[model samples]
Target: MIYQQFQRSPMQTRISGPRAWLAMAISLSLICLSLFLLPFVLLFGAITLGCLVLFSRVYMARQIAKLNQAQANAHQHDHTTEEPHSHVYNSVNIVRESNAKETHRMRQQGRTFEHKEDEH
Candidate 1:
């Protein structure tokens, strides 16, 4: 509906004198230069991308080695006999404690409101 009432102004189509010639010449020169340098630009881009990929691979290898060494050290220093399920139980207890604290605070602030749906 908004677009149906909208009106656009006419575009200018007339250009004369030296300004028009200058604009044409500049545009043509830019087009020619881009065409001439396209191949060189592509070649440089490929070389740079290859170098970046190689560098990333080497960097990732170094990081993986460091991680492996750290894991080995951690294993050597770990002497606990606790089972993994103990951690889950501990996390659940922590969450319960946090929720209790939040509920207590909310009650103290008199904001303990419950929403109920109306039934016909």
Candidate 2:
């Protein structure tokens, strides 16, 4: 009696007819479809990544170009606002100061005569 109570009743057993076959067919079809589409799915994923990288590079280039244009415009604007200035700020009069020590040293060295007379 105790073992009988523990045993599953036939009424509670799984139904195994068309329902089981339908479930198995659906699962098999899903597996087959996924297998068939796997390559396409991978290819599409790679293409999408490539497109994203290409678009990002193009976008970055465009942004850099825009930034360069803005900098150029800003420089031109700033240049226009500034007054025109002369290239020479102040004329410097370079007066050579003769050092007494340098003059004495030159006098001591006398005249260096290394003149080679032209042989006529």
Candidate 3:
């Protein structure tokens, strides 16, 4: 409906004289230039893509290193500030309880044991 409202009739259309020639010439020149520069354009695009990949890899590596350093600092700070014996005991207990629960659940689901020995 909107397109029909805005559409111009064929009688209103006009392409004549120097303006049409200029438009055709510009388009032809662009086509010729693009054809001539196709190889160069592709090479430049590949180089740009490679550079971007290298830059992203370096940036991600730096970010990961910073995260690891921060995690290490936090871990070190926690150990230094807390009572080690209690923390260690609590962590061990938590791990044991979680392992026990997982084992029990797997047993209930009939997936507890793996066949280690070769069957004849």
Candidate 4:
């Protein structure tokens, strides 16, 4: 197998040598060019982002304005049909009373005690 491989071709290697060199040269040149243009690329990217943000903000503001205008128009049209305003009054009253009483009756061997508590 080794001998068969060795017998195949020096011609293919000779042709591939220039092709590989050309490919390497092209790759290196592109890498250098991109490095040189990096700052410009970043500046344009920032400008694009700023424009997008500005456009979005303006669009949102216009949308909000339209919504507010629509609401105002609807409110105006509904004003006549809407119910009249009504006022409500609420009142609360609280009363509290407390009483404590105790009585002791009995004599001699023991005493009897009575206690009472009431609230209203």
| lDDT (Cα, 0-100) at 39 in candidate 2 | 100
CA lDDT, every model vs. true structure: 0.76, 0.78, 0.80, 0.72
For each of the candidates, give the backbone clash count. Answer: 0, 0, 0, 0
Model 4 agreement with the true structure over 1-120: per-residue lDDT tens digits:
779879869777765777788998999999999999999999999999999999999999999999999999986876756667742222211212132121111222454546656633
lDDT of 1 by residue, 22-92 (tens): 99899999999999999999999999999999999999999999999998877665535556565534433
lDDT for model 1 comes to 0.76
RMSD of 1: 15.0
Give the per-residue lDDT of model 3 (tens digit) for 12-118: 45666788879989999999999999999999999999999999999999999999999999879978888846645454344434578786676568764566778
Ten contiguous residues minimizing lDDT sum, candidate 3:
88-97
Q: What is the C-alpha lDDT profile of model 2 across 1-120, one tens digit per residue?
A: 879866987655565688877998999999999999999999999999999999999999999999999999987986777677723232232223366565556566974647578843
Model number with the top TM-score: 2
Q: What TM-score does model 1 achieve against the real structure?
A: 0.50
- Minimum summed lDDT over a 10-residue window in model 4 is located at 99-108
Lowest lDDT sum, 10 consecutive residues, model 2, at 86-95
**TM-score of each candidate?**
0.50, 0.57, 0.52, 0.52
